[model samples]
Target: MPDLEDLYREIILDHYRNPRNRGELDTPPAVRAEGFNPLCGDEVIIYVRLANGVVDDIKFGGQGCSISQASSSMMSAIVKGRTTDELHRLNRAFKSMMSIEPDPDDPAPVNGNGADIKLGDLEALKGVVKFPVRIKCATLSWHTLIQAVEEAQTTG
Candidate 1:
């Protein structure tokens, strides 16, 4: 078995090598949002399917680093079956864990337990905080996801 760090590394690499929900969604009423990490040139486009005050499905398209790609994959997986409120909360938790500020009006990454978060796999990205520029790479997808959620609430 791989060591803890190794396992996390593998998780990161696996997500990078083969991302989930990478293509666009075909829904007519889907809301689209975009995120860009100017520091690393990381970018993502998020599509959210809104129905009954929930996110029916989520998808993403982007080019970015391992952290960004992996996070996007994970985000898609978790948000697909979640409500808009749940998604918003999760984003707040994620942003908190990432040490980003929590401004009420501004859309934030999830907070609290981050139910959908796998700590070890995500811990692999902890090293990113050490590199300021790379922080953007790690957060690009999450930023996109937040945009997608916000757009869903407004457009849908």
Candidate 2:
């Protein structure tokens, strides 16, 4: 039987090889944000839809490594249909995860609202913390999602 780490690697690879939500939205009211990891030339585009204080939809498109692709797939799976505040908290929590700054168990607290991202399978990505260069790859989707949410807030 493969160990947990090996299983995690397979999960990541599976997500990368056959991504979920790998496409563009149709004439979406959503604003798209694109992110690039200059070091690896990895790119990700995040699209978000907000309607009445809640996210109606989310999608992503990009090309990159297992880390980036898997992270993007997971992010898209979680971020859609969340409120703006929820999205912000999720964004912050993801940053904290990549930065290795906040405790995933506790999540990064958001202002005084007491809301936070509930990191799930994403925590498996913690192995990425040991690889600095791979950090950007792991976080491309998250950063792009945040940027897209910001753009939606301002222009959408």
Candidate 3:
């Protein structure tokens, strides 16, 4: 059997190879946000459409390393149909997962509300924290998603 790390690596590679929600949405109805990481030259563009405070649709486009692209792909799949509050909680949970030191006894991390957030395939990215610089690569799309949602709130 493959080790957990090997499974995670395969998951990341699968997303990178066949990204989900890989495209663009029309702007008048969708809020677009772009994030660039100069350290690694990973760029991600996120388009989000909100309806009744829910993510009506979401898509992503960009070019970067496997981590960034895979992360954006995973994020797009996870965020669609989620409410803005849920998205925020997920963002917090993902970011927290990226930053927190791993504890052998504590495998799961909670969001601000102290509730366990099931990360799904996103759990594949937990290993990214081992490389400090790659954490930004993993989170670029998430930050852009937050920006797009905030923009939608201000303008819509």
Point to the candidate with the largest TM-score: 3
RMSD of each: 3.1, 4.3, 5.1
Candidate order by decreasing lDDT: 3, 2, 1
Estimate, for each residue in 1-156, the C-alpha lDDT of model 1 and write its tens digit: 358668777878887888888899875688788888777677888888888978788889978777888888877876777776666666666666676765577543444545565443555666566676776777777777777767667666
- What is the C-alpha lDDT profile of model 2 across 79-115, one tens digit per residue? 7777766665776667666774533343335553323
Clashing residue pairs found in predicted model 3? none
Writing each residue's lDDT as its tens digit, candidate 3 over 72-134 gives 999999989998878877777887788743323322334353338887889899899999999
Q: Which regions of candidate 1 are displaced past 4 Å?
A: 106-123
Candidate 1 lDDT at 80 equals 77
Give the runs in model 3 whose Cα sits over 4 Å from its true position: 100-115
TM-score of each: 0.83, 0.83, 0.90
Model 3 lDDT, full chain set: 0.87
Least accurate 10 contiguous residues by lDDT in model 1? 106-115
| Error in Å for residue 147 of model 1 | 1.6
lDDT, residue 36, candidate 2: 92
